[model samples]
Target: MPARTSRMTLGRLLGLSRENNRARDWFFEDSGNLLPHHRHHELNPSIPPLEVTKIALRLRHLIEECVPCELEESLITQAHSRVITREVVLAAKEAGGEEYRSCVVFALLVCSRWFKRQAHLELWDATLHNVRSTACEVIAKAIIEGEEDMSYLLHTVLLHRFSILVNGKPTPPANAVEKAVDLHALRVICSSGYQKCLQYLWRGWLVQDEDDPTVFVDYRGRDDQRYIVHLDPDRLRAPVYQNIARLLFSFIYLALYTMSINSVNPNGEFDAAEILLFLFTLGFICDEFTKFWKAGYHILSFWSAFNGVLYAVLTVSFVCRMIGLSYPIGHELRHSYDSLSYNFLAFAAPMFWIRLLLYLDSFRFFGAMLVVLKVMMKESIIFFALLAVMVVGFLQAFIGLDLAEDLKTDEIWFIIQAMANSVMQSPEFDGFEKFAPPFGILLYYVFTFIVMVILLNILIALYGSAYSDIYENADDEYMALFAQKTMEFVRAPDENVYIAPFNLVEIGVIVLFSWWLPKRQYEFVNDVVMAILYSPLLLIAAYFESRKAGEIRRNRSRGEDDDDTVEEWEQIEDQIDFEAEGWTKRCAAVKANVETDPAVIEVRKLMDEVAELKLMIAELKKGMDGANGKKKDDVKKGSEGDGEDS
Candidate 1:
């Protein structure tokens, strides 16, 4: 008792410096001396290690056991498996926190294994979904209640890679990098399109901790909690509302650009519309530049690459327009530059429309489809790589043949056109023989076969594979995309967000004083300016947040659980079947009243009584049969004794 030791709590461990990797390990490990005693006590007691092993082995056996021709055996196996899973899930629910997380991780691992081994077990799909749903609820509730930080869930629970203790050393599982709780959870959350989980994710993005800027930190002093928008009410700066406001602004900008480009006045000075378009484009350029500065190499993503191309064209067009204005009206040079400007601007129209898809990707249909498209595009790289090599080889052959035959250099363009046409399914085979001789025509035919038959088919196969992979796991892919988009917005936090053309004002006005001002003063100035500039959008945000607040209040007053989000999601899911007499509605109605219905209740009781009566009758019949057999055996033995006596 010479020195008293303070106990390590979960909160204290979490508060430890994130750079100390051992702290994270200690927090997550299940073994002795690793976990804090108090935290472990808070968790529901788990089944003994031996029992858990036995249960796991049983589950594995059930998953692997195949009874293809026997339907009854298969059904029995499935029912038994389901009962075991439900029991485990129930235990997990009772034991929350790490216990619940461990159960979910095990379930997902098992599901993956089962999917690989026996995907024909359709009954498992619902059981797996239930496990995921429970996991989602745990994280969602924790985040919604502000009881735990998102960083803890993401890094420690979900994204945390588990290792086996092999000979007193940590050994990583196979494909440990990709197969993690986070990936499974993300896929589940994304597939379900659950709003509560999404809210937790995006909200966590805004959280900033003093110890580690990358992770969210919960402060002991509530007032000192750090968030990007901590100085303001969340109602006024919600990410959802902010993104919606930005989308609306983008549509307006697009409309302005369309009008300006279409109504270009050659040989005349820029009009009001053109001037506004320039400002908006400038604002977008600034936004992209900032993102580039912050995201660096990460800005090389598909969407960002598209943005880069669009901005580059717009910049060139704007420069051309400016140069045209420098020249006198009706001048040849002026008209030439003006023509180039309009043409370039018009060329970007396809990109502008395609970029709109990025905003709409939050919708499940679009989001999932975008994931498919991205994957397909990635797969096309292999086709393009092969095509490039083939094209170069064929091009050289044609050029060499032309040179040998002393054909006009102008004929080279025709050969190029023919090769392209063949690839496009419009083979121009008419003039290939004229280039050199039989060799030229023969080569052309070979090239066509390679391009149209072999290469194209290979490309198609690749595309199909990529498409199937994404579509089969559409929910998870979409969730990953959604998570990516959410991060894109929050990854580079601007001390003050200035959306588009409005950003131009911030740069021209607010930034002028930023260099000379103190850090706090600069931040304060930016916040105040943004609050004023975004007041209208803030009002909209306030309305939505207030309504949500009111709902929570009403729920609490009525002593009802705050499960409004779940209820809303369920309702929305039901609404997907627009027909009044839809299967979902029918199922819900029947389920709700099944237990309460008098007729069904009576019938269930009668069935139970009939089953008991059947058991009694079978026992009585068995007893009477045994008595009759014994009497026959005794009579036979007595007759044998009488014969012996005679």
Candidate 2:
């Protein structure tokens, strides 16, 4: 017969088995002491057959209550004989229902914990390996089932065994139960079904403590107080503010660049091509500005303010153009000319270039405003110079024609006229007629010559200096060249054609003068001239201020010392009067008063004396003190000092 059947038959046949069954009932009744080996095995092994039957019945009852399945029954019997294996547990899991499988798994955990008490090495090793493997597989399945709270179950079963294998042994099983649990967690993280599980693990599981460095709080729904991850506020704020500024600046630049291009003809229809280009360019600028803003620059505010005005002008100009109306200069042309007389005023009124310059110098409000005015005037000056040259050439031609026809002289007046016209018609003179001239015909040539030679040259130089300052690195040098080329491309009448060699030559001259000239020298020259004119007055004022400050400090120190001395004297007098009234007071107090009072008077007198004698005495005393210290140090050095002295 099978071992289980034999045991049952034995129990049924004996009357004494009834008493054994009662003892077994007592043994298996409570869960409190059921797990420990001592409680289960404490009964005498040499007892009657009735007692043995009773123990067997008690063991069977405990197994039924705790283990809950046929597999656990087989495991408990096999465990006693050291025959149970991981494969047997797995087979049980495969055969049983979900509840049975859970029960079997739990029974294996209890058995493994019980086996830890056994001295038999082989039994212990086999039980530990089997339990760990089975636990790993079961936990992996639980994880796959999309269970959110499997981590705790995993830790309770296989995590400890896995950690032991990792820490204590070198050759842990290749297909260990711990690895299966990890694989399951990884699979869950990758799956859409367990996204919340993965998030919980990421946010909650890996949190570090602020106070206790070594302690880790396990995941539990209860108030098991734990640390949380926090982002640095300053780090978060920097990028946000930077991006805002960048966006504002970019918008402003786009508005200004577009408006300036469009405002050439007030009554003309808005160019669809330019408008599209403007939008596209604005988009690109916005993208670049976003990058700059994200990097944490504060220059965007100036650009924003500038762009606001430029956008307003553009809106008004676009409205006027769409309505087939000119932007109102004034009631009369003369008044309009008068209003736009100063080159600085004209550039500032347009708003585009002025705003761009201001945006570029965002850190300094006043400085940015000045830069805008300067840049606007500089660009205007270049155009005016070109215009002046054209006018001069036109006049020379007219004069040449008149002389050739009216004088009836063999003058090369026609050649002069041709030369003047050639100069006027040069590509450099493209935008000269935009600014209306007052004494049109007569002053045109003279003005043109001055504009070309002086104003244009100055503008070129200014641009070169600005570019050099902005781009200090070798890479920046390349970028500066690229920017210059781009500007040339934009300025060219036909997009297809390259800038002419003559224009390049002119630009080169401007760049050379602007960049190579010693700016500091010029500044120094101006400073020297100003110093020569007003430095004496500045020196006088500075001297007066310094003297006043010194006097105030002196008076303060004197007053403080005087008050302290008066207080000291009053205290000494009160102490003396008290002492005279009481014989218990020391006569040394009176002596101290006399000595301290004289010394104090002497110190005050010394302070009042600002003569060289006190300084000499102080110097002599310092020297003597230093000498005495050196002698004392020498005496301490004994033999070395004596040798040095000899």
> Scored by CA lDDT, what does every candidate get?
0.58, 0.36
lDDT score, candidate 1: 0.58
Please give the TM-score that candidate 1 achieves against the real structure.
0.62
RMSD of each: 12.6, 44.2
Worst 10 residues of 1 by lDDT: 1-10
How does model 2 fare in lDDT?
Answer: 0.36
For model 1, the stretches where C-alpha displacement exceeds 4 angstroms are 1-195, 201-237, 407-409, 464-476, 490-492, 559-646
Residue 1 displacement in candidate 2 (angstroms): 94
Residue by residue across 589-639, what tens digits does model 1's lDDT show? Answer: 777443244777789899999999999999999999999999999999999
Model 2 C-alpha lDDT per residue in residues 1-646, reported as the tens digit of each score? 0001011111222233546755653553332121122211112111232332233233233333433322332343332222233443334344324412223322333333333333145563554434333333333333334333343332222222211122344323211122322232222222232332222222233111223211222222111111110111111112222223344544554564556454543334335544553444444444334435543453344445455454444444444343432334433543333333222223434564454443243233434344444445555666566656665666555455455555743434533453455444433233223212233233444545655566556666767765455333323233222222222211111201101211233234445554656754433332333333333333443344334334433443454310123445565654565555675465555544432346677887788685667888999999999999999887889978788999
Q: What are the models' TM-scores?
A: 0.62, 0.18
Which ten residues in a row are the worst by lDDT in model 2? 226-235
